[model samples]
Target: MPASAPEAPAPALPRPLIGWRLLALFYDLWPALALWMLASLCFTLGYTIAGHHDPHENIAPLSVLQWALWATCWLLAGLYAVISWRRGGQTLGMRPWRLRVVGADGRPPSWQALCARYAVGTLSLLAAGLGFWWAWIDRDRLAWHDRASGTRMVRNPKP
Candidate 1:
């Protein structure tokens, strides 16, 4: 009998649509919100337990407490996204939409890339979703985070 030829590798999946990414974001927000609420409770409880706070003191624009809370939320959310991406490429939200974030080399992203993605993603959201909209005009359909972090979201084919 003749030897069988080697099997061909499967082709890569297509890039996900902006609308699918947006839907995944909406799903992801629920968990992020829960994490934020927990952080808020801890901050409030600690502030109250410390006691002797000035009742008449007004919050400055650059309040330390506010910044701390914001940092807490940022760190938690970053950990969630980065770890998920590194472990399996799909987050809890992305799984439902069959989305996977892959680096420029078409493999899992490095820690630095994931961090950049999270930071740039924040900027993208704060910019009134201009980053997401940018895909409509981008030749490769990449968003701000995808471009900035050298990562792209691709659709996962069904088994």
Candidate 2:
């Protein structure tokens, strides 16, 4: 009888390039924007119902209420990110590009890690994306969040 042929090993998964990461972030911004708008609408309605003189007046800039609105938006965005990462390791935006967040061992990360990732990612954005840009110089091509959270984003192989 002829010997059976040896099976080939699977190919190594490659890390996603910065361009892909940026594209996913850009896609995610749309959903985040929509959520922020909804939150703003609710805040505006509450402000008007509180007996403000003008029904159509905008929330006063730098007021306590305004600060609350900003905080709500930030929390909401963080929830969106943490939940997505926890549930499936991929957000809506990451789905299209096949990007997934995994721990150093390549398994789903912990909730704490996911939150850390979101927090660091927020700082990265606030710093003009310098954290994201760090991947360019990183030997492992990891972003700031990746390093801080001990998580990494990797591209899945095509099915």
Candidate 3:
């Protein structure tokens, strides 16, 4: 009799582990801080170019511009996060950490899901970051944003 063909192996399931999440967090934090620094520099330069005798003198305009820049940065970050998450389940941060975000059914998240993720992420930071910390205690290791969006961050199966 001819030799029987080998059976195919079962596919691996996604795992949302702590180490990967922490690594992703670390990767994300530096870029966010860099953006903040850049925004501050731009604000200072704008104040100087406006010919204010003292940069501090034009407090109102500076405040408004500063807020605008900050909001813009946040929007950019959210867009980046959503696009990356949906396309390959990994952001620049998550890629380095070998982490990926996927919906509950192991599919790419929808646009609405992405919005939920970003909204929760923003609120998490605003509220002393408890939402980010939720992953640490949650049984499934999902952050608050992941929970709200019906998504999960898991170790990427492919290289």
Q: Which one is best on TM-score?
A: 2
Candidate 1 RMSD to the real structure: 2.5
Candidate 3 lDDT over 1-159, as tens digits, reads: 999999997675666576676678678877767766776777777778877547665446557776887787787677777887777778778876678777888788898998899899889878887887877888877788888989877676665
The residue ranges of model 1 lying beyond 4 angstroms of the native Cα positions read: 1-9, 53-62
What are the per-residue Cα lDDT tens digits for candidate 1 across 1-159?
A: 999999998887798889999999999998888989899778776776677354444334477998999899989988888998899998899999999999988888998998899899999999999999999889999999999999989998887
How much does each candidate deviate from the true structure in C-alpha RMSD? 2.5, 3.0, 4.1
Looking at model 3, residue 51 earns an lDDT score of: 78
Instruction: Output the lDDT of residue 94, model 1.
Output: 98
Between candidates 1 and 2, name the one with more favorable lDDT: 2
TM-score of each: 0.88, 0.91, 0.73
lDDT of 2: 0.92
Report, for all candidates in order, the number of backbone clashes: 0, 0, 0
Candidate 3 wrongly placed segments (more than 4 Å): 1-12, 34-62
- Which RMSD does model 2 reach against the true structure? 3.0
For residue 102, model 1's alpha carbon misses the true position, in angstroms, by 1.1
